[model samples]
Target chain A: MNKFKTTESFENHISKEKRSAKAKAFFINFLLSFYLFFSLFFSSSYLIYEKNILPSFFYFILLAFSFIFSLLWTSKNSSLGSMAIYKTNKFLKNRKELQSEFNLFSFSGIFISLVLILTILLGSILVDINLYLLFSSQGLSGAKRIFSALFQPNWNIISQVLSSMVDTIFIAFLATFIAIPIAFFFSFFAARNLMKNSLLGNSVYTVIRFISNFTRSVEPLVWAVIFSVWVGVGPFAGMLALAIHSVSSLIKLYSEQIESVGQGPLEAIESTGAHPVLVVWYAVVPQIILPYLSFTIYRWDINIRMATVIGLVGGGGIGTLLVQYQGLAQWNEVGTIVIVIASVVWLMDYLSAKLREAIY
Target chain B: MSKTILEIKNLEKFYENGVHALKSVSFDVKQGEFLAVIGLSGSGKSTMLRCINGLVPSSSGEINFQGQDIISLKSKELRLARKSIGMIFQHFNLISRKSVLVNVLSGSLAKVSLFNGIFAKFSKKETDKAMSNLELVGLKDKAYIRADELSGGQQQRVAIARALMQDPEILLADEPVASLDPATSHSVMDHLAYINKELNKTVVCNLHFLSLVRKYATRVIALKDGKLVFEGSPLDIDEAWFKRIYGEQAREVGIE
Candidate 1:
């Protein structure tokens, strides 16, 4: 009796497995067909809209063809979870034999490749790309003139470029220095884990998070424009702009570090009856100090790159000199400023990377 | 007869996710007894230990410790109350990057002013006491090393030393040996046993193995599905009671 029961249960298990496999195959096929139809229809419609030469009837016909092709292919092929399709009733008796029916190149693979090529073609049309025009006489001459002038940089402006480069670097330095303490103060309030206890704490968390997010959404260029109007066009304006953005960015980095701190040490310190400040000092500080230093060094690197650009908006630095020389069409002077900025940015990036490596 | 130092009445804890971690449970702890709370995982053992120290506030209960209800205490009062109750975790929750000596000295932050605590300026007396506690845990030589550099057993021993620096009246240990190997578990347990017997501090510990309870605990309490199932001497939990507490399919597994 036990042997008979075991045989029956084994049959039941196999039947259940077969049913689940069938359902899974159907779901996968349905999703693939739906995706194929959408991609084909959308790409064709986008092409017709952007090019605007094809008629409305042409789009409708393409859409209908995609829909009908996906439907008919899905119904006829009925993919069997792998590359094989369900074609005959004979293979239904043994699922294991279905593996031998695998195809090296399937219709779905061909259809997907066709759709990808169509997408690339549509992207070229959308961008209004004309590769032939780029290598035309007019384009080559424009490029040649800039290249010849750039190769002959004006050495007379080397002293001016060096001094303005120092100003740009100092703006980044002072901005980061000012932002460090402010971001450190706001980060504790912004961390959800730290301020989740009371209604007042939750409100402070929301307010700090909202203000940082709001300020961060405004790009440094826009902020530099605003600060130039307020503080008058100088390195101070650039410094203020970078400082504001850095505080928000650093708050986000610092608070996320605080949230991921191991709760074990925090609980241990709390259990010691330490004051709340001391709990944060002892537990949270040790875990976050290295990460915070790493993030600050990273932020300083970004600020240096931004300061060079912020000077373009009348905030005084090497960027102001480059823009001035460009406006006058003195490409040689512009080339000198460009080289100074590039070399400085590269050195800053390398130093920050090394500093971050040392910290970790 | 020993005096009851801690009294818990109808202790109920409902977590924010609507998990009823602890049902209406009540128990008493004597002044100097080593009480072992045993249960399966998620049976409210950790939650109960946390609630007693006001770490995880009880949903509704009265935990009377030294003439004060721990659940009703304000933040300042809670900090003051927590000073007398030293707790250690299974993970040995030391500030991993800090020196072992600094980790121990952090336990005295409750009594120091906020200004002094901020600068981590402990007095010579406190430093000496921290050293003595490290010596008690047989880790005086390891004091200058980083807390994370130690082995698991050594880290746990340092955690015990840090807890001892508080000079607490009651020590709550949450599954102190659950993360340790059997041999290391015995060594840590021996230190706890020494604290309970020689120093005469009341020790309330959460444990998993019945054999360890039989060896170390003066009294045992068993919890099942958030309800107290048994409260008696450890030796009284024989085969029948064990089967009932741990479920019928369960069999005792010994570490040694």
Candidate 2:
């Protein structure tokens, strides 16, 4: 009788533990769903629909509904509360393990959908987004005038724009060229694998990493403004700005490539009794050369695009000419500059891709 | 009678992550003998080989190579000492993108001046020697091909050729045939045997298979849990000794 009673109690104990677990889940989910929908509904009604206080009658109904929904959501002790209901189709059911945690379609899904829809409504009101504006008479007329003028670019200003475009390309080229060697030199010191051997190496690694991250976080246009103020505004200022930013960006790319190189070849070369410098040249260089070249070309592509933006901040290039015509409302002249920039960028993209492919 | 070329005493390696990889390991390697070291994975076979060459620094021990204590040597002295010790790995460790000739020539990097090494300007003598090593490994025709284009067995042969560029007195092979098929394993083993006999270079090899050890090794040593458990001829390892080393539940698996 005692043995039979023990078995009965063990089964009861398991079910009891399962019930408490389900109840805990239900309570937590009830709080979360209530808070999410409440805030979403309250904010939309108050801000978008211009209601001062939350609608008490509607809120009470929602609270009662959410309580019942959460209870059903946590039934069977499953997770995610029907969040992945759409994934329960025949194709997905065939791959049962790929299905998400929530398996059943329940009332909780309705609450979540309501929260998502109301959140979008609140977001649109906050941003003042009105799709009707696009078709409004005022907006349509302005867009038509600008787009029509843009289609018929001023051919007379083509020569002037071409000179500025050359300046823009030169600025990008010089910036990328100047940054290459500097970034290359710094990359060895920046690599964690190479610099992790000694305390001094680790310190150098940290400092170099910190400096590069700090520089890269600031945009090139901001640097262009700072350089323009420092150097009295020219393509030289733009080149310097791009060069500085490129050095930091390229160092990060190069060092990451260096870090990912296989350690087996390194140990093999070291076993040959080579000097550390020779070891790097033989083992590390061969591994990283192709990736390094690929990354540098990628950087150059970015620098060319950035050079145009920098020019708008009084760092001399085609963007300077673009802003000048734009300020004067000469949309046709602006259109010509934009076409030249677009064609050059497209050409650069094609050339770089071909070069990378050839090297690979 | 052969003389002792290398002697290791009380070798211990404690990695920073607190893995006591090797514990008081000691052994001797005789001149011109094909010595095989066998163990399960993580049993310190690789670590013991690396310690002999000072590739992985030992926590405490004496590694007496020739007459010198290798553990006591400074960095520059160690590099100089490493020239006399050539090492190969299971993966072949060749620079995959480089030509086979360049990969072999790189084995002589220790002898080349930095400026020449930087420009990849190998001396004619070095190039000829590299070619001869390639010829020795029977890959002379494939010298211009990229290292990755070759098959696994061929890549290992190239690695052997690269190691030969050092012309060292001793060759340490860490699981040389671990990554190879049975047919390829024997071929690579045959080359190693030839090198041991013709070149008269002392070889210390780590092996996973007892059959290969029995076939190629003059003597065999076994490590269990980072300690030397058995040291004798391959014929001496009976079934009882195998169970003692590999555990009672183990069954001997043969490659051939």
Candidate 3:
């Protein structure tokens, strides 16, 4: 009788634990539903006020239906409730899985936030003056006008596009070429394992990082305009601007690549009585070189496109031609220039992909 | 008896995060002697080996190698000191992208100048020497192959060859076969033993398995919680001694 009672009580205890878990899950989900409803209400109100646009009452109706649907779903599917709780409870049960999930979530969140911020900033600027206003001020209108002007094959338009493209390409190339050596020095200081003294290493890294941020923050177009006033219009001004930006970007990428290298090879090199610089050259550089090359090529391709845009401000290359075409109301020519630029960018993309495959 | 080639006097290291990695450890290694350090994780065995090569700077201690205090040596002097001591890691850390030949040649970086090193302007003699080292590790055929192309055992052989290229007087191996299979572990240990016997190089190795240490180590040192608890011959280390060194708690945890 005593043994039977013990068995029965053990079974009862397990069932009680299960019941409490279910209850906890249900309560948590109920809170989530309430929070969502509140958030929906406030978001809808804010959207209406900000945009001066009312979403149809149907959206509110849909929200109410969804909430009701979720409640019913949770009641029937305790398994689903368990899964939802599992996300939060995961760290206690399986640490590796939790860490990986957290990493992915945070990385994606940061990336999405950056994209949203950039889009909003750019949209606000573009919406005010508008691309149409800038184009219409020169008296070019309709797709027909653009087509005719392009079909007529004006040499002036062709020349302007060619120059801008050349200027852009040259700027990217020159900037990258000049920045590579400098970035190498900065990356050495940035690498955690390379430097023994953390304070000195961190200070060096911070200073270089600050310099890079400052350089990259000032857009190439702005830099070109500033340089144009200082050195007058040409490819030289554009090159300087791109070079400054390249230094900052390359340093960041290179340093990160350096940091990610397996410490094993470095430890091996250090053990062999190799100097710090030698260790870096052997262990660190070998690991990072392929990735660095790929990043550089990609950056160069981007700079070429930017160089063309910056040329409108007289920094030199195809942008100068683009500006001239717009001033002359030659929209068709502008379209042709855009096509050529797109083709070049596409070519770079294909080549870089192939090269990365070969190296990697 | 051979002269004492290396001496450690009250060597201590405390990490910036306040982990007492090594606590006032002292030992001497004679020329051409084979010493195996046996310990579980966080035992300060690896830390002690790193201090000899000046890889991990000692917080308060003196490492005297060839009658010179290695701890006080700065930049170039440190590099010069490092050249005489070669190290092998458990993971066989080779530059995966580079060919085996280039990996081996990396060991000679200390002797070569910065300009030659960067551009890989290694002399024909240096190249031949690297090839010979590869031959010693029996990977001469895999010279042109990338380091990643080889198996774990093969990669370890390549690493050994890379260290040999340094023509080091002392070889420090930190759990060099921890990543390999049992059969491969024996082979790698055999190679290390052969190197010690043939080249008359002083070898201090950190080992996980006691069997391997018994087979190779002339002198065994055991560490527990950053403290050296046992320093004696292999024959002297019986099961009871091991129990004392590891403790009943560690035995229950299955540390062996």
The weakest ten consecutive residues by lDDT in model 2 chain A span: A1-10
Which segments of model 2 are wrong by more than 4 Å? A1-141, B67-69
Candidate 1 C-alpha error for residue B226, in Å? 2.2
Each candidate structure's TM-score, on Cα atoms with residue i matched to residue i, is 0.80, 0.78, 0.71
DockQ for all candidate structures vs. native:
0.31, 0.28, 0.26
Candidate 1, superposed: residue stretches over 4 Å from native: A1-46, A49-137
The value of fnat for model 1 is 0.71
Query: Model 3 off-target regions past 4 Å?
Result: A1-160, A182-186, A189-192, A196-206, A327-333, B1-3, B119-132, B244-256
Error at B68, model 2, angstroms: 4.3
lDDT of 3 at B163: 90
TM-score of chain A of each: 0.70, 0.70, 0.61
Of the candidates shown, which would achieve the greatest DockQ relative to the real structure? 1
Residue-level lDDT of model 3, residues A238-346, one tens digit each, is: 8887877777788788888888889888888777777677788888887888898888877777777777777789877777777887898867677777677787878
Q: State how far residue B207 of model 3 sits from its true place (Å).
A: 0.3
Q: Which residue pairs does candidate 1 place in steric collision?
A: none
Ranking, DockQ, top scorer first: 1, 2, 3
